[model samples]
Target: MVSLICTLQDHRDDVNWCAFSPTLLATCSADKTVRIYNTQDFSEVPYSPLSGHGYGVHCCCFSACGQYLASCSTDGSTVVWSTDTGEIEAVLEHPGRNPVRVCAFSPDSSHLVSGASDGTLGLWDFRTKTLHRTGAVNDTTMVACSFTPCGQMFVTGSTYGDLRLWDLDMNQLHAEKNTHDLGVTCCCFGPKILSGSGTVQFRLASCGQDSTLKIWTVSRSNTGSCKMQLLHTLTGQSAPVLSCAFSADGQLLVSGSVDKTVTVYDASQGTLLYTLNQHERYVTACAFSPSTPLFATGSMDKTVNIWRVEDGHSGHVETATFSCEGRKLLCHSRLLVSDWSEEDVGAWLCEEGLQALVENFKANNIDGAELISLTKETLASELNIESVGLRSKVLRKVEELKAGCVCTGVPDEYLCPITRELMKDPVIAADGYSYEREAIESWIATKNRSSPMTNLPLQTTLLTPNRTLKMAIGRWRTSQ
Candidate 1:
């Protein structure tokens, strides 16, 4: 049943954010509009459109309880709306001409953190309906910000290829890990699983331009400092990851890549479990529902795709066409939304979207260690040559072996008796038995099984299944 359910189309421009209201759904689009629609009907009733930002809308998210909606704009304005009346409850404005990239509500729904092109963090208090404080950093622009599930703290990533962890309670900075060589695009939190144990706890997953997905274990000490250690690195796709999400059970991870593929991986082993290729262009966003096996994705191909993650329950519907331009796609249960694709080339960005899909256990410093070691071993096995070096050495050895450079001094036990031809596709018998083509060849070459055997070269023939290869071999042996 891998199919996508069709919903209503309300946004005229690229829809950036979609959130579930208690009974309805709200979508924000670059058309400088936010519209609320009934979940049951795709038809649009009378809806309020908040208009103030001079530029396109970037993103929108609902508060924990879905009472308030937060929207960020390319003009660097952040607005909070009352869901009941669609009135502007709070406005967050920045002086810089930079665009607002992301805004997220804390678990308590009291504070909202926003990242913008100005390289600053805006913290707003809902009670005051005003900006609480703006925190500035020396880094490049910030792209994505996320609060831990516990809401004790938050983290932000930037185009400078760095991630900053912060503690909200103490306002003290925690450990920072810099791994990607490029900007981060998106980030998601996942659960930490104990090795070899079925039960799982909580952890964080991040994606970025590095074309990698990383998992980190979040740690907090008694001093109120947070530390995130690398857990695993998942890499296979060649393009930057744009989005990622964890399944409802927290046991599966799905990632969308600019390579135009959505890959499902074993979250624990970082194994490439499945690849679903339906989008013709980059897959911008993906989300899993509260129900197991159900998921949805948005893509640049102008579609909202919904499918079941379970092995044969694919909903049968492959893709959902939106009939509009899409950039960032997200799904909450069955609700789906998409955002505009960014055009600015050099702004601070979210964590690279690829790293959020896998677990990256190595420290930033130890990265590339495995690749270096592998290269070193490959070089060491070759003979030393002044000019041609490894290439000449490898060619010379290949020629020698091809010319039957059998070693006479070596002990028979230390040698591999199977010839190259036999080892090419060797197989063991079901009866706990093994045979080598070389041994059989030697017996046939020597005309060994009978007295009528001659040294003449045996005729080789190809026959159909009615005269199987096994029968041919039997016939040859009998002729000897």
Candidate 2:
């Protein structure tokens, strides 16, 4: 595994907020400049220097769709920038004291929220470019506020060590929890909305200067009473947590801390998975990709370090499939997506489907050169799992195609079953390698063992589901 660290060309002065985009990343610093860098080459890109704020930029974030960026400044002003043109589209000023430290956009891109040192929270409508509401927050200087993915609710935290959840509809406090000992620097919501498992509408996580991280299970009872329950507290670290981000699936959490370390933990179990001690100074911000199983951490060390997780592969074998399906299922089960685009999505899924075919061929014990010849002619053919059947001769052809290739897919194990989208850290596997919907089809084709199964005229029915399942079928067995 190769790890790359990114640093600015000129050292930034008092950089406060940094956000990642699909193709580029933006950073706001005290030097009165916002620098945008290409994610691929780490090269600095030309971005118009925004200078309306009198003092400095404090916090910034990219919209969920990556179309707009919102930033707050010490001058109690907020501006929305067009990601394509690097032009300021809207400038909003809050008549508050001191600086506006943090701002976030709702998931729908309709509302923007800013928290200030003046202990006030300001809300604005991005569509109308008008202030919608302003309210006095708790004594804690409201530093960070984020809307839940649903956009119906938002949570705000402050230096006074208070966390408050609000309902935008009723314009009332849904719940309030004062559990931190210091300034609450960062917070994130869990990916999965709790439904049938219990009343959990969402999971909230926050970190503060108290050197403690807490997780809360927030639920709305049928009677309309919102309850915030303390779920777990992580307290092994001695440093104040600066920023926290949940993995794509909320299965894992990553925290950047003043202790110069980035810690990874199982969000559900609160188990420390790994600690990256490579940064030289305090870690400022951490983010995980929704498309790929990779994490990015920005630090006072003035660098963004990228790290990847490893998944184990069994072995390669060859098999023959005499039967032929009309079309193929292009499964990109193993390809990793750091930032996905339309073209990337199509290419990844196609590659993964072919990879599944290749693995099946090898497991059936097929030859290499023959597989290469098959891929050269058939890879571009559109194939869906519903149309494919597991006949022995067909499986052999799949082996032939994959042996001619390297890197069948991404290394992450918890991938989407259909689209083969790489699950983020804390990813939960609802089904097979792809999304849940596609996983069922994969299972039917690869499994469904009861009577004798047929690849060609040959009948092999003794194989149980466990034996034929992708998780178990291996070409090389040590015990054997």
Highest-scoring model, TM-score: 2
Per-candidate TM vs. native?
0.58, 0.61
Q: What is the number of backbone collisions in each predicted candidate, taken in the order shown? A: 44, 43
lDDT of 1 by residue, 326-356 (tens): 2223231121111111211000011111122
Candidate 2 lDDT score relative to the true structure: 0.59
Across 363-480, the per-residue lDDT of candidate 2 in tens digits comes to: 4333333333443224334222233333333444344324312223333333332223332222112221222333333333443321111111113322223323234213212112
lDDT of 1 at 376: 31
Top candidate on lDDT is 2
- After TM-score superposition, the amount by which residue 180's alpha carbon in candidate 1 deviates from its true location, in angstroms, is 2.1
